[model samples]
Target chain A: MRRHTFTRFAEALPAAVLAACSGPQSPLDAGSDEAAGIAILSWVMFAAAGLILVAVLALAAAAARAPAEQPRWATREGWVVAAGLVFPIVMLSALLAWGLSITGGGGGASSPPAAFRIAVAGEQWWWRVTYLGPDGSALFSTANELRLPIGQRVEVDLTSADVIHSFWVPGLAGKLDMIPGHVNTLPLVAGRAGTWRGQCAEYCGGAHALMAFTVTALPAPDFERWMAAQAAPAAEPDNAEGRRGRALFLASGCGACHAVRGTPASGTIGPDLTHVGGRPTIGAGLLPTQRGTLAAWIVDPGHLKPEVRMPPFPVFRGEDLRALAAWLESLR
Target chain B: MRRTLVILGLLVALGAVGALLFAWSGLYNVAASVPHWPPTRWLIEFGLENSVETHARGIEVPPLDDPALVHAGLGHYEGACQPCHGAPGQPPNPLVRRMLPEPPYLPGQELRWSPAQLFWIVRHGLKYTGMPAWVAEHRDDEIWAMVAALLRLPELDDAGYRRLLASGARMPAGESARLLAAVGPAGEALVACARCHGLTGAGGGAGAFPALAGQSREYLMASLKAYALGTRASGFMQPVAGALDDEQMGRLADHYAAMPTPPVRPAPNAATERGRAIAERGLPERGIPACVTCHGGNALARNRLFPRLDGQHAFYLAQQLRLFAVGTRGGTAFAELMQATTHGLDEAEIRAVAAYYAARGRPR
Candidate 1:
């Protein structure tokens, strides 16, 4: 009985790990049509590869078991032509066709002409996502996080500020390189409402591993509401602590790099933090957005993500840090 | 053996020619705009890691738990290191971020190095990287202080760090103009005094600096003159005093003397008792005189030049006593008297007396 239990646990271990991988961010958990198509292609390739491996192994084993003196079914030349040339050509052609069909079937043609469009700029270790209004002007700006409406095709215009960086949302769309001085367009449609993960596929610098973002696909109405809220300036802090924090933020030279929309923090050096409080993560997805984590990040961003642009504030202490954190959180 | 040798020689010749050809080809991209190939990058990183690890081995780390050391380090870091390394709640300069090998933010990076390795890297700096060596080579103590601060950096929040920076002597606002006016010919030079002595003359914490508040105007003036005339030797204070004339010196002395003194709050413990005993009673066997004879509040009226010791930082008092015993701190003629009085007292006795005086009643 003990052995049986141990065996069961051992067998279940891999399945358990695989199950854990099916998180909101997992590529295997396809929440969008694009991701599902990729998944299907992946399974097909896996099955084909498995069959090829089994066939090759079986042939080798059968050949070894057969007597050397036994007559061959066909000459060595015939076998080589059949297995290496003909088999590969047929299988590869089929796989290529499938891949082309999946990729060539662009989501834009099927979607409405008035699709939501966003421009995502890849920085050294972060994403600068801007939503565009009808007139092609930026409606609002956010960093490290992208929000899309479910069942709506969205076009993302990708570009890079410095070195080359590839934007990849494995759960939503294929990887696309964001090259400096060039813009690449990627259209994605989320068939379901869920959160997915996006990461910088290219190695940009010291913090490339830490460069990640969340893609939350909400219902059409909810996404519109979120966009509207993001477009507005940050609300006035409600409490005395928050007010003090806002003052600290301004006084401490935070406004010189980050923007809070309504505030005088109109600097363009860092991310737009107008609706930062509502975001699920901060520091380019290096940390979850919580009061404690936000405070810690403000205190020392380099600690959380090495080589980050944000400097630590060794000058703020106690009530000031708390107040600043509260005020930032209240931005939502 | 002959055949092997010939083949080896030919291979070496061919390898050299190949290398020469490659060097002259100009096919290798040397652009800073692009990163090295993965293998090349890995090799360089590997070399750096091993070199740092090897050189950092066996370095004895000093006890870095002292808050005072951390405070001092924070001050130095803010002024010198913060531009590139950055502190909590600030970002590095934008131009600095564009460097090829970007400087890592120290808060998270501090954990990667051992305290001793940090010291080594800080003092010697990494070769080929933008990190610079320490300007003051002999100040290992200051470097250690910085290491101490780095060790605690991961745990410190912005507020905690700011508090550490603010722990030292604070300058009083609205007094610079008055001070400048008081020392007419001195002009802006008087402002430098506040950097160490503070605008209110309260001194840095725990007597790392001496409190100038409530000190006799005559003593202050005499000390400045001694410093100016080379009668007293202090590497830190001599330069400032040497630059001033007698009138300017007198005005600065008066300015500090007139400033309001801070309240005394000494730690009360067994040390305080021993300190009080040493101050009140003479060590008859050791031929040590009671401190009250010269420095007590009761004796202040008799000698106008005697500096008031009450409510002064113990650290400063103990340090002065040690300096007097060593005959390095030469003050006015009365300094000899201090040397003689302090000659017989041991380090512990001196500490006790300093602590006692530090906890004594406010300066009259």
Candidate 2:
């Protein structure tokens, strides 16, 4: 009984490890149709490979156990005809056909046209996401996070600002390279409403390891609401402290690199802060969106994410720091 | 075996004699104009790399993520290190470039060393290299600050570096206007004060210098006198303070004391609360009086000799408190009281109370 229990535990160990491997970010979890198809194909290939391994092992065992004399049926010529040439030809042909069918182009002919489109520009260490309206004009701009409507085909136009970066959201679709001066298109449809993590797979520069974002798939109406809110300018400060914060924000030279709509801070060098308060994370997902974190990030972004372009603001102290944080948090 | 041993011993003795003779001969070139041979250069560099790596292996780095550290490091770098090592936009002096084994440009050099390695190099500079050890060895915190700034050097361009260096000396508009107007005839003399102690008395050197804002007028005057009379032994302050006459000293003291106190943000630590507790309610068990009884917390009238601690830098405050605990920092009449009060407090208690006072603000 003890031996049986031990054997059962040993069998379950691999399953436990496999379970731990498939997190919200794992491609094998397959939250979308494209990812599911890829996962299914991967499983099929793994099983076929396992079968091939078992057959080869059995043949090797048989050969090892054979007596001094070889059987007539197991001649060298016969082994070459069956194992060396014919078996490989048949197995390879089947795998090629199966792969072509699964990943064949124009497979989405029966699906409806894409509901919306997003253009993602990859920079040194951050993502610049822009939602495109029907007329090809930008509807809204956000950074480090992408939002999508569930069960809707969305076309993502990928490009680069500085160097080549790959946008890979494993739970949704395959990786696509964002090449400089050229736009690559990727169509994705998430079947469920959930939050998935995406990462820049390319080795960009100093902060490449920290270049990650989140993709939140919501119901159509909820996505619409989020888009509408993101389109508007940041709300005005409602209190004296917030007003002081706004003044400090402009006077402290923060306007040189960042943009805030309806304000004089129109520099396009850094991320847009129009609706920054609504985002769940800041500093390229390095920290959670909270008052203390926001203040800390403003004080020293390079410390949190080393080699970031933003300089530390040691001049801000006491009520000034608090006010700045309050004004940013009130943007939503 | 006996023959082989004898041969080996003779060889060792001959080698030592040859080395001593070579040293005495003075035939080896030691001119700065002459570069080391490739092998010799490689040996020195190899030794330096291994030494730094081994020494840095066990160094536990403190939290260098603070922006304050970076800002202070930039100021120190511009003042001292920039002459030898070039900044992002500014090049090193031409004379320094001609030095043997020229100092490498530091903009992208931080990528090669880990934080601990950088700390070790800064703390204990390499031999035969012009890199000198930190002047103040006890200030490891300042070394870490420079390391933090070095790590961020790659991200900044010329304009960005200039901006960062400029940010350290900036004063509020109102304070600047007021100070500029007050410099009637002693223009250069008055302006010199703003160089280290900012126009608003906020202190440009971070914790390297003390903030003069919100200090009691009497304390300022008395301290200046102590510096002038050679009672205070600061090499940096003594010369400047000694140069001033009675009228100039009094006017400067009154001017800084009257200025609005700059705000000092409290560090996010458990010590802040513990500090506030001790500052408000005295640790009676330890025979310490509540700090507010004399320092003036709410609206209480304070003694002029007792310096105002509100809005002072936590680092400066902690340093002073420690000095008082050790009975070294002397002041006006009530200095003994501070020494006695601090004698019963531990390091943590002193730090907490200092932080509490540093974060406190004077009533309008």
Candidate 3:
């Protein structure tokens, strides 16, 4: 039963991966390595469940065979009750110990050192991620998706924007709730290389079903390079289109809902877009990053994403929109 | 034993009968038109208010760093919020005024909450007051930052509010206003966005402020237009965009898109780089689209309403996309594209994308 569903899920993934390769680099190869441990853990759990099912069936059969001659208060009935109480306790205690060990319990070992700390605040529908600088200073901040290297240990400081939002990545770790005001901590490590899937485990609201994210694992050096890039100061464009695009960004009022690095558009009602060109996806990887799609979204944002905070730019299309897209793309 | 059982049965039957009679006789008025009796209204209000307070009690609040959280929140306040909650420089929208429990003027009556409480109100939203929960999860930082910013409302005047918006404020002299303008001979055009985003692009807004130092550029640019066009769908963005033009928008997007992402990050135990690769490239096998196609790829000729994402906040990005995918994304005119793009993705994709984008750096 497990094999059937597992194979089906696995097969569909590769197909989808092949279809998404429109960029210079991808994490396909790296994904397998990262997901190995997580996959193993999941499979192991499934196997354990299967074993339990078999055992229960066997026990049921035995009970049926022996209970035919029992009276209401027979000595055999007392034995069954005692077995139920003692056996479950013993088994559960062992399982608990095993589970704790896997999660890095006891004095035998300490948690992996935290390479970095991210404070994630769960809002009604979105996620707020704040990066901590080496010195514990507040550094980079943004929303949705949390990125990390394959081997590093990260301390995720989780909180909620409103109601309860549970953060969970089926392949990496268990679920943790982000409650309003209070911060919860979750320790996560990507075992190998690969992208792991996750979602809001708690019911937050209308957008709860759509709240999702990916954890990408990469080589150490590559991750380091990424960190350096994330730390660099804002760069100004050196071309006319870029200049026009910059102006358009502010005047068009993109600043009201978003924040860009080093600009008058310092509003924080939405995502921080200090490096739009650097990313490969938008709407958290929901839409293909394309000029037409971007243009369509801009011309009428409400049509693309309903009930969102940022408004539409009615005065975009053709050259103007093209110029804007060009300038934004050239940023990287 | 029989008599006791009979009595118990009779009590149960009576309870059931009472409930059925209540239902059949229309004992409770469900009409929104008439206000509930004072006792019922108070009971409900108390239940909702207290429940939220009790449940939210355990939240751990990090100390706020910047004093400008509200200062930055001003732009959003003027642009979207003022329409619903009357502010120093503006009055409530006539349409919003008609809402059943018309949103109050935050500066006057709604300022009683702590920043966290305000954040909860904004992020989680009220039950029947037409208040909507935050469009996305993990966006509490932005909302809380706004709440922190709102703390100053009582002391602000129309002019003060406008000033906070950078209204009439020009970038440092000699700074180039546009990317092309900022280059060569643009020594003067190099205005430091750090004044707001800070030296490292880590935003200067207090606790709830967004970090612009390290965000995805494409999402940034797109977000800007979404606000301007009222597509991203924020109640606060329209008026903000009302005063600005396209050129300024593009320039801002460019500057931020070019900034380096922050160096300090959350403890790196998270498997974000794998997600990063997806953001930098695409998960072809999963049918996940590349971020650059619209945000930074060659497919587009230039920037439009989209803001730059070089140093944006990760929490904010993840939250917005979730909003879009679930039909809750709000801002300006171009939010529709986000909806279309997000419609097919499952929760896994959104999380992956958020993590990938969160760990990204300035694009090359």
> lDDT, candidate 1, residue B88?
84
Name the lDDT value of residue B50 in candidate 1.
89
lDDT of 2 by residue, A115-198 (tens): 889999888688889999988899878899999999999999999987899999999999999998899999989899999989
For residues A1-332, could you state the per-residue lDDT of candidate 1 as single tens digits?
64466456555655665674477566767877778878777767755765676567657656767876865764568878988999899988998998898878765376566486899999878899999987789988999998889888788999988889999888887889999889999887888887888899898989899999999999989988998899889999888999898887765546545779998665454788898899999988888888788899987788888877665675568988899998998888
- Name every residue pair that clashes in candidate 2: B275-B352
TM-score, candidate number 3: 0.42
Indicate the residue-level lDDT of B142 in model 3.
58
Q: Per-residue lDDT of B57-115 in model 2, one digit per residue for the tens?
A: 99998888766567667766766677788888776678887788988878745478899
TM-score, candidate 1, is: 0.50
- After superposition, candidate 1 runs with Cα above 4 Å error: A1-21, A107-111, B1-364
Candidate 2, residue A150: CA error in Å?
A: 1.7
Off by over 4 Å in 2: A1-21, A71-75, A105-111, B1-364
How many residue pairs clash (N, CA or C atoms closer than 3 angstroms) in each of the candidate models, in the order given?
Answer: 16, 1, 257
